[model samples]
Target: MYPDIPIRDWTFENVSGGTTGEPVKFRHSGKFFETDQGAKLLFDEWSGRKIGDYQIRLWGSERDIVSGKKDWMNKIYRWMRNEVFLNTFVMSEDVIKKYINVINETKPKMILAYVQSIMEIVKYANLNHIEMYSPRGIMTSAGTLDEQMLEEIQKVFKCPVFNRYGSREMGDMACSCNKNEGLHINTFVSYIEVLDGNYESCNLDEEGQLIVSLLSDYSMPIIRYAIGDRGALSSKTCTCGRGLPMLKCVTGRIIDFFKTMDGRIVYGDYFTHLFYPCTNVKQFQVIQDAIDHILVKLVFFDKDVDNKGFYFEKENEIKKAMGEGTKVDFKIVDDIPVSKSGKRIYTICQI
Candidate 1:
């Protein structure tokens, strides 16, 4: 779709997990990386960390791991950047214990992770009475960070938790400053707007759809892009005195935890990651009907395609995380409906 941007200029190619629809493959130019790095620098400054500080990133990508690139790439990157990666794909008790051990060994100055993933770690740590190395700050992204989750994370880690809001299509757009009042938009690289049903801008503090334009991505300019999120802009200035604009709150991405019969809690994003490579599926929803039952609703691009084999293959993996006795049912549907708020939530826990 982006034919104007030359292939040589595309430095990074990635596929989003498609929380709302089918997976999307997008390319980023070298300039996009520069702006992304700049945004991280701003986050560091706001979080009271300096550049080149040691940090551990709790992130995971099934594609990277399957392609066998994450192992060597992470090793080299860790050596050059003073960073470490602990995959959050599987959150079993053993994995969480390993994560804690890595943190205590590395003693990173900052811990950056997906909100739900780190929340799982904190929950496990608290329950098991496991002590962790306190970092200077914690940065959360990729999921909704509510007030309760934020407070719990701060109490467990004994550090300020900064919530970051962004997407794969657009690099880091807004992040909470040290003031913790709200997330300040990276006005230098992007413009943000909150719109109502009429597609007009909403008043300050009025909840609406978030529309963003990447000012720095000229190669594949994204203008007035409806970013599939609901948020509001703040009217008050931050006490830290940064002139950047702020988001009063982001309330669009809501993912629930899936529980196993054995009392294990799995992050909702794990199921989303499971279907990232299923390009034939147009959209999907995972619903935990009971502790040992899961119902998956799928809308495929071609309704006539045989999907039984796909279902059986993924069913085993789901059961592995949810319990061996778990019953996973896959139903092909004509459409997966959105919520009353016009958002397509990929994961839901009815229990």
Candidate 2:
């Protein structure tokens, strides 16, 4: 249906306050078309090359920067560089000393990273008792920054906490609106659809799967891409008065009931309440290393020196939360592994 519409026709403009203006914010960011092609070529030429992900752009330029010109050849030559470490990308330090060094030496008021890593720091501080923050977004608001732990984190850290959501395929973020909890879609880049389990489109008030469509497609056309995340659209408009469509919430990835050792498939919100309340605990990760065994890695310290009270309390609580007849062991480790993008998954249930 959209075959004739040129990709360059799309532009993200600020229509805040219901006032429509010329499209001034024309710049598009993130992985460009040529960059992905270059990455693929390097992977092919190098004998032992490792390819992380593949990106495709629709009708966008392949240059380092988007050109105002509308031409046929948009692909440009570029190099792919893997970002090593967050703190060290600014300067390289070993992982062991990175966090403490940043907190002690740099001593910045607030620090920002992926959700999982920030949670880890919080857990460590709760167990050991330390404070951390980044200059921006220490307090999550009713607008874009609102979150489950936003209030709790604010009470502890007393700073702004912002929530940002997006994916590589979706182009840019669907961040919390500055005006309210409503998520502002990157209406500039992709078309969004909310769908139910039966492949039917969901209404404004219903929970459903998020189906995204990329408006631009020079490198690769992502038409009606079913991103694993679930979310829904909202009927309410913002006080900020932008007439554009709004998204309500991202429900994260959908899951089926996991059959336990007793042959009962369990699915509910029970797991959310388990570890999240360990107020002082900063980060928690559960990895199913074996069929009947799981390993937990946490970064924390305690004045008790041996960390007897908090440690045992956590283990017992986990066993209770999970259920009976399940023998799971928790491994207290100094470090936890994060994905290439620095986001860590809390509960990695291996089936």
Candidate 3:
């Protein structure tokens, strides 16, 4: 829908499909080249995603725009929006259950799950003494999670929940290393520039918007495109040293961080690694409405999870973070809802 490629006269049928020998020429947005590059990378990354030849079929459907129901415009609107959002959000129950079962059976050392449901799994891991992977920053949703929210996500686990960021347009862009707290930009695929308010190069320690030039897409080349994030470049390099780029003070989206009674800051990355061996958990989310009131939303594996020592363990840990006098609460939600876009925000903060 967005690339806006014009269909040939023969493609005017209700449903049309085709094969392209070369990249699509119509809809050459700046990303045409980069999309090409990413396409190759994607092919290599998930070589088995395609087992045989396939023809991409494009069609139009109607939607109830007023009630946000499905209609032709809505059908086109959905795919026109973002290619990745559609894939991430509208997954089948069987697909979700497959991943859930894999997690339960394998009990991996680390897991990187979305916000709304990751915690449900973490809750289960905690009960079984499973040490899930959690980073020190926000357990951001599919896109970007703000700093304060990242802080709160991390507070759920003693270990840090490392922050990772990327988009369908942009491949894997940045991830915080196990050794360092700073996020390292994946410079192999793209170049990054920070622009000040005046649209000039921002000085070190100065906060500015990020613009990216993707080096990988031949199908879609995005040059000097804004990444919709604000951050400060680090003059001092990191000791962990992967040597791509160092970023500090990343404040793109709004994240709320509150001080507990004892003054500990809450972050999202705090929750990532906290759920590993907790096999009975499905997914979860943590909601903080106030400094004293924190709610734990959970979805379980068997409709009923072992609550035996679950409450006492996390209660003490949370008390340590919020302080001795803070009051905590729990909400057992049947569903930790997903957004219209399908991205799940793990930590919701108000304070």
Candidate 4:
């Protein structure tokens, strides 16, 4: 649609990948930054996050921290925003303790982070009997937040946990309103639709792959972009009264689902329930190798915690859920690897 836009004017680039492992770069004009920031602020204000609020971002990598330290401009910008970055990639006992201490001291107004990173901190707080300062609200992004994890995060943080669904390729697409009902699409910036395998729109409340069309980025127009996520449209209107359409749920990427022995498809969230309140378990991943065999990789907080009892209990639960015919093997590991996209994969189905 953008015929006269100059390629040199595109100032922003977003790198994303599909299951095939090739990286695709999307370009956007500088104007997109302002529009995106405005939409984010508008949605965040509904959750009581406002300007000049203390924002603690549980994000960043080793490279990000190092770069921030080396570049005065980035450091100043972060300081001006009153934002602190806690490196989610570097999680160790001493590092977590320091993070907890800093958070307790700062008492931030907003806690923005990946769902899993915050969940890990919450688990550490519960285990160490450390009391964290209550923030106004916690806004989670970059990954799907399971119901169990949401409940625990709210319980520990004592704040409304807003789930945000977005991909780097499309920027911020949707966020839950204060009503905590469902994620409202940012209609001003993008058009979103749920489509079936045939590329036709799915009926309301029916699950399908999500395809997005970004209206704000004409410099490199994205039309019906398959974002590789699954979700459903809400049949009911949100009580919050926003005219924007609602997404019932943003199930993670299509690869996150597993096939059961009976050929039934089970979502990642279904297996997530197995580790609710996930106090003892530090991290976990479920791999379905075959119709009859499943491998569970886990990392426990305490190396000496009653492994035998824990395994027995979890094995029974897995059997009950997956079926008695399915075999369950528990292997304790130091850590699970993140995906090539730098996001954690919870479920893997080889079959």
**lDDT per residue as tens, model 3, 1-351:** 555543331211111011111212222334433444454334322211222221111111111122243355545643553221112243334544444455445433333445434443334344445543332222232444444434544654444455555544565566655554566666767677778868999987676887878665444456886655567777766676656677765654224244575666665435433332345545566667776777877666566656858767767776767677767666666565554434454555666
Higher-scoring candidate on lDDT, 1 or 2: 1
For model 1, the stretches where C-alpha displacement exceeds 4 angstroms are 1-8, 63-75, 254-351
- By lDDT rank, best first, the candidates go 4, 1, 3, 2
Candidate 4 C-alpha lDDT tens digits along 242-262: 878999898887877777777
lDDT of candidate 1 over 1-351, digit per residue (tens): 854655456666765557645767777788887988889888976776787889888875455334475667657756776777777765555788889888889788998887756866776677667777889999988777877778878888889899998887888999997788999988989899999879998999998888999887656778898876778999988888887788998875433567788877676767776774465765678999888899999877578778778989899989889989999999888766544222346788777
Question: Candidate 2, TM-score vs. the true structure?
Answer: 0.57
Ranking by TM-score: 4, 1, 2, 3
Clashing pairs in 1: none
Give lDDT for model 2.
Answer: 0.46
True-structure Cα RMSD, model 1? 12.3
- The per-prediction tally of clashing pairs is 0, 32, 70, 0
Sequence-dependent TM-score of model 3 = 0.47
lDDT of each: 0.78, 0.46, 0.49, 0.79
> Lowest-lDDT window of 10 residues in candidate 2?
55-64
Clashes of 4: 0
Candidate 4 residue 191 Cα shift, in angstroms, is 1.1
lDDT, model 4, position 89? 72
